[model samples]
Target: MGNSVLVFAEVKDGRVKKVALEMLSEGKKMAEKLGGDLSAVLMGSGIESLAEQLGQYGADKVYVADNEVLKDYTCDAYAKVMADLIKANEPAIVLYGATILGKDLSPRVAARVETGLASDCTDIGLDDDGKFTATRPMFAGKAYVDLSFTDSKPNMASVRPNALPVSPPDESKKAEVVKVDVNISPDDIRTTVKEVMKTAGEKPDLTEAEVIVSGGRGMKGPENFKLIEDLADVLGATVGASRAAVDAGWRTVDDQVGQTGKVVSPNLYIACGISGAIQHLAGMSTSKYIVAVNKDSEAPIFQKADYGIVDDLLKVVPVLTEEIKKLKAEG
Candidate 1:
């Protein structure tokens, strides 16, 4: 018999990524429902210290493979290490974050392990028999379907960040740590991380933001983003961009949200001048409350929005901001 539930803990700068903890929570729940142990695997250079964080998230065991050659992400190197771990542990199920690194590493590992993989899953649950049933968007987000894997031992699934809420970590519980060595050569490593340029800020990432204010081509120019910014500032929300705005060079790719970009599910999503193409809606249809402001009364966005205002965003956004300010003052 092999391990029960195994989570791939993503490590950045010798620390576990937030989504890694979220997966551990999901794994913990699944393992409990199935009456098994939940394990986590961490791989990176000088990241043995991250095992404790996995324990906090309900991992019963932590397997770590630390080496300088595995310091950065390379498709070949990471896939090799992960495949070996899964082969040795033979976990019943494995979960990974749908982040860039995970998107690259998971498929290769799944192929090596000869298992079925569900990508960017929005929901996962244990059936009566304890099999993993994952749900994800299909047909360009028009609907969703449940996916199941029967012939696989370690059913692989990659889940979107912020799609599932993260449970708080418990520090009192401790997990057993297992150390492993990865054998890698220069020939196996293809890509090298040259430089990492991260945007400086305390602001939450768009995928994790509770409130998001987005702009589109109707905003006219990049300079016009100030209106969107003002509304975001008032609401303490992250700024997002439609593919049209990003293609127009009005915003960076990181700010883009759509089928070709990042998926976001915020508590409140405000779309200003966005036409709500099927692709764009695929990324944000999960938002709890949608508000669309566009001059075109016939825009498709209105159909999906909880609150629709058929007015020029330029005028309506300012008035909305002023009203918010007035309410704050009255309080």
Candidate 2:
């Protein structure tokens, strides 16, 4: 690796994740600015063939550390492999997607390599001096700060999922594939993977969702959330809930959208029965469009809503769902 910008190319099932491709796009731009090559580091079992796809997204080289032990992600084994690779390659910068796996893995890798990491970053760029700079939300998404790693080589940052644009792939581009045997011994891994329990749903991931339909305490009770779910289904959208709704047992914590929960930036956000507290706004204020439905016209949510409907959600959501399905069927 020569003066490289390296991205952690994450894969799910048998395909590379969209966020990883987005990282490659951004990393490619940064690599060009720094006059360096862009590389992707991938770890999995029998995934060497997937390296070819990384080039179209703009990687100059692809490093594949394929092994049976690496098939399932174990914190110790994964971190040790990445840490060792960073020490050897010493790329100018490293990046990962701020997904669940990324959030859990990046910090450990950073600490293992004795480097600082900026997590959930919305923006990353180079300073006038060509130093790496990262910008992330703070104060419950109420504030942001630009940071740089002055003391460390190969500075690291985890880009927030969907925060960056997904660039068109260049099929003409090809990256050199370098296979490395991390050879993580059984003793090296303290944690053993047993069985994975999957969540029972076909819903899209909240962070990666293009459209989201959310509810709050105004949903009244758990059963009322079916209305929110119905609307989400009509729009092919993910379901989200305000912290108040989650705390009230109306929705699961995983569905919570706020400072204490998930941060999402979707193409469209529909808020039903939500009061629009600052904490909740912090999570979804960046969405492209916001539609709020509540009985109280003076609710704080209305202030941030691009479209507001002043009526009881119980009366409105079912009608809206039916209309949406009708329009879809008509088309």
Top TM-score: which candidate number?
2
For model 1, give the RMSD to the true fold.
2.7
Extract clashing residue pairs from model 1: none
lDDT of 2: 0.89
TM-scores for every predicted model: 0.89, 0.92
Model 1: runs farther than 4 Å from truth? 1-3, 199-210, 233-236, 319-331
Per-residue accuracy of model 2 over 19-114 as CA lDDT, tens digit each: 899899989988998899899989889899998899888999999989988999888988888888898898889999988889989999999988
lDDT of 1 by residue, 246-292 (tens): 99999999999988888887889999989999889988998889999
Task: After the best TM-score superposition of candidate 1, give how far the Cα of residue 238 lies from its true spot, in angstroms.
Answer: 3.4
User: How displaced is residue 247 in candidate 1, in Å?
Assistant: 3.5
Alpha carbon lDDT at 251, candidate 2:
81
Q: Residue 293: error of model 1 in Å?
A: 2.3
